[model samples]
Target: MLKDFKAFIMRGNVVDMAVGVVIGASFGGIVKSLVDDVLMPPIGLLLGRVDFSNLYLILREGTAPGPYAALAEAKKAGAVTLNLGLFANTVINFIIVALAIFLVVRAVNRLQAMQKSKEPEAAPSTRECPFCASTISIKAVRCPQCTSALAE
Candidate 1:
């Protein structure tokens, strides 16, 4: 059982999956930062200086009866809130990540296509003999099966 477990752990795919998961987690963090710090600010500024971070609706009022300044304040006050801005921000993050992945995949596919194009094309190995009812090499000047002269 231990040996089986060890074999499973040592497999190339398992190791690769683990590495991918770790990298993906870090990549998620970077994307999140990109959405929050870099992208949102410019977008917010473009949209008439609207701050997305603080945009929320209080579903149920907490101890306070009226307007809350931020999402955090509402949360801290035990308010049920709809974080519309956060949801929108997350959607944007998803789009950015998806676009990046699409571009990478497109580039990889292009490279693969280029590699395939670079490979030397193989010559035809077999051809139907006109004189005989048999298949023969395309290079053959004569059909071996029927012993007939073949045309060029």
Candidate 2:
């Protein structure tokens, strides 16, 4: 059982998948940071200096007070709230990641297509006999079975 488990773990595909998962997780973090720190700030500024991360709706008042400045403050005060800003940031992050993945896939497909185009087409190995309607070698000038002269 241990040997079987080891074999499964040692497989090339499993190892590659593990590596991909780790890299994808790292990429997700990068995309999250880009959305939160880079993109959202400028967009929020353009919308009259509104802080997107603080944009939320208070469902119910907290123990502290009716008004909570930020999502963190609301949560800290035990208030039921809808974090719209956070949701927006997450959606942006997902879009960036999806686009990146799409571009990578498109590039890989193009490279494969180019490689296929570069490869030489295989020469024909066989031909049909004109007289007998039978398969024969391409090099044959006459049909062996039918004994008929074949055109070049």
Candidate 3:
């Protein structure tokens, strides 16, 4: 059982899948940062100086006061808040990751198509006999019906 388990773990596809999962997780982090740090900030500034990360609704007021300045402050005071800003950022991260994956898949598909196009097609093997005018295999040394010698 242990040997079978080791054999399964050592299979090329399983190892490749594990590597892909790790790389995908790292790529997701990069994409999330790109969306939050690069894209959202500019778009948020254009809309207004409103910080998307702080946008939230307080379900229950914090112990300190009626108005909470930020989500972190509200959370620090043990307030039950609906964090819309973080959700927005998460949505942006998902969109960016999905688009990146789509582009990669598309490019891989195109490369595969190009490779298929580059492959040489098998030529037709049967040919007409020169002397007898009969269809015969190109590999045949002599015509079956006429006994005519086939060309090399």
lDDT top scorer:
2
lDDT of 1 by residue, 1-152 (tens): 99999999999999999998998788889999999999889989999987899888888999876677778989988899998889988998899889988998999999999999999999889999887679998899989999899889
- Candidate 1 residue pairs in clash (backbone atoms < 3 Å): none
The estimated TM-scores of all candidates read: 0.76, 0.85, 0.76
lDDT of 3: 0.91
Number of clashing pairs, model 3?
0
Alpha-carbon RMSD to native, per candidate: 3.2, 2.4, 4.5
Per-residue C-alpha lDDT of model 3 across residues 74-120, encoded as one tens digit per residue: 99988999999899999989888889899999999999999999999
TM-score, predicted candidate 3 vs. hidden true structure: 0.76
Scored by TM-score, the top model is 2
For residue 29, model 1's alpha carbon misses the true position, in angstroms, by: 1.2
Q: Rank all candidate structures by their lDDT, best first, as comma-separated numbers.
A: 2, 3, 1
Identify the runs in model 3 with alpha carbons over 4 angstroms from their true place.
123-152
- Residue 17 lDDT, candidate 3, scale 0-100: 99
Compared with the true structure, model 1 gives a TM-score of 0.76
Instruction: Please give the distance, in angstroms, between residue 44's alpha carbon in candidate 3 and its true position after superposition.
Output: 1.9
